[model samples]
Target: MNLALHSVSYAGVWPGQERLSLEEFIPRAAALGFKGVMLVAKRPHLSLLDYPSHQPEKRQALRALLAEHDLSVHSLAGYNDFTVGPERPDVPFWEHQIVYIAELAALAHDLDCPAIRIFTGYNRDGLSYDAGWTSVVTGLQEAARLVADFGVVLTVQNHHDIAVDYESMYQLLSEVDHPNCRAAFDAWSPAVQGLHGNELAAAVRRMAPFTAYTTVADYVALPRYRYEPALVNYVEEPARMLGVPLGEGLIDYGTFFDTLIETGYTGTVAYEMCSSLRDGGNLDSLDAYARQFQDYMSPYVAKANAGVAAATAR
Candidate 1:
């Protein structure tokens, strides 16, 4: 498995820190020892509208930058929500997203990226469970078809509301039915969902065949407290998750990665600092965390590479 740094780590969307441009981010990722990068297809990075089909110069510039940094374009992540606006026939949000995905697919092909990342929609009001599910399937199918022409696959990350768990993700990928549609399965969601040991391993095995990539991040839940006037006591609110270095968090990446490596996952393992961190989101902090991730993931990367090597020898 190749190690890639997702641009969102420094994009600063969550913590309100200043975002880094792709020009600055590419070299930083390479400096942090990332072999490749997953560029967020949004502002402060590479948006679809900014790098349209007609803009060969923009693509060329990005390619040149990647070469200068000695980095590869692992994937382009598109922000999508297919569940909302399910009842609005007059609105064109869904159509625009499909077109945007197709555009991103073209850009991925131009940059020699094999995959594009997307999210399923969050379950919102005005949409029934069954209706929301059908919408996701249809949207992904269309997106898959659009990208398939470029030989680019759509890897659905488990960040969204639909198809987050192992069983649902497998079912979603199977239902999409497009050869280009696959899962970007992550350990965080399954870990948070309470899967562990053989159960988690079995889930990983089930999604292994359809999984082309996985995003990794570690987090620890911070307990929250709220004052209650009626009871004259402080009530415990839900714990807020804060990002931390790999081994310091609650995620069981040891078992998670062991299962994936043994299953012969020859895909990219992306490290992301997506939430509020233990330290602030400054470049110094980001760089430190990023380097820590590479160090933490070294053994797993070795394991995955050895698995590939053994399979090839066979």
Candidate 2:
């Protein structure tokens, strides 16, 4: 398996694009030994959201920058139109959501992204679990099938909001029922539902058979999970968020990595650490923190690589 990173780790540095263009992020990531960079497909690039102007120029520059930096575009972090609420006979909610999803699927295909990350549709408004899940599964299945011919994979990711747990994620993938549509296991997100290492393991095992890719980040246990809905829905600062340092966080990475091995999962494990100060007291802290994280996880990653080599050798 290969190790990569989501360049969004440096989100703080993005607003200062003039000071540091997208090209700057590639070398920074490459220097950290990242095998690839998963760039966000938000307005700055393509998509209906925020591609104000110079969008075409920005897209070309991104491609050139990747070539110049010798980096591969592992995935597109599109964060598409996967949402949830109760279904209704009169409401156009479900139809609108599905149409939005199909449009995003075509956009993903046009950008040449092999995979696009989506969240499970769940709304807290008014509905039973069954109703919400059914709507989610139906929407995802139809949309995933729609994009299958384009060779694009619709991967349901474990985002914080409404992502129930291991069982739910497993079920959603199964319900999709298309070979090209698969799961992108974002393991740490389950902690939001208060599951432990063993429970997480079981979910991973269940999802593995259908998993096409995986995203990883260290989940730091917080003092208390506050309900901060405004920003990232994170309750408080110093919260138990993912994307901290490799081993310092609460996630049982040893178990997670072993589970990946046991499941025979052969895909890139991208380092998705997005912590603000966890990199260090400053933005420039990435260099030092990246080295330490690589050093800390090296033994396990090396062994994982060795196992792959031995198997490939045969």
Candidate 3:
């Protein structure tokens, strides 16, 4: 298992986090001992507007930078929601996203990245659930076909609303039925959905076969309360999830990693600090968290690698 530091950790999307350019991020990730990186495919990183497919020079420069740091780009993360404009049916939003992914796929090929991570659609007010499902299925099918030409696989992460659970994500991948389409499964969603212990292990096993990539971020749920002046009391509200360093939060990564290893998942596992974190999101905090992930996952990675070596020896 190749450990990758996702660029989003330093992309400054989270409050108080400082943004780092791809040039700055590459060497820093190498300094932190990561074997590779997972780049966020947007501004402050590898945006299409910045690294257009026609601009081979920019891609080459970026490739050279990665080589200088002895780092490989394992995957590129893309942002798209196929059910965004259900009310505006005439807008052709789906087509626009498909084209966007195609361009990203081209960029990934140039960067020597094998996969592009994408999400399914969120539930829309004007669209029925069935309609949203169909939109994602067809959209992924087309996107998968488009990226295949570039030798880039489209990894549908279980991040969005359409098919986030393991069962539904498995069904979604199976329904797409394209060789270029695969899973970028993560434990965060299932953990938040109250799956744990044996149940969580089951979920991982169910999606293991289809999973080609994954991202890790530990989080703790902070319970909230609302003031009710009339009743002179506080009303309990839904909890707010906050990110934390790996192994310091509620996620059962030990179980998660054990299952992945047992199932022969020797794919890229990326660490991301994409949300408001408990220790705040300054560069020091981010680096510490990143280092913590590296420390936490080292043994599991070593065991997985040893298993692969043993299999080859036979």
Cα lDDT of all candidates, in order?
0.88, 0.64, 0.93
Candidate 2 lDDT by residue in tens digits, 258-309: 8877787767677654554443534456566556666776776777778888
Tens-digit lDDT track of model 1 for 1-314: 88899999988788655488888899888888887999999887998768877879999998998998899989998888887676677898888889888988999999999999999888878778788888899999999998999999999999889888888888888899988999999988888888878888888899988989999999999899999999999999889999998878888888888999888887898988888888878888888888998898888888788877887899
List, residue by residue over 138-165, the lDDT tens digit for candidate 3. Answer: 9999999999999999999999999999
Model 3: ten consecutive residues of lowest lDDT: 82-91
State TM-scores per candidate.
Answer: 0.96, 0.78, 0.98
lDDT of 3 at 102: 95
Q: Order of all candidates by lDDT, from best down to worst?
A: 3, 1, 2
- Find the candidate with the highest TM-score and give its number: 3
Clashing pairs in 3: none
> Which ten residues in a row are the worst by lDDT in model 2?
13-22
Please identify model 3 stretches exceeding 4 Å from their true place.
none
Q: Tell me which of candidates 2 and 3 scores higher on lDDT.
A: 3
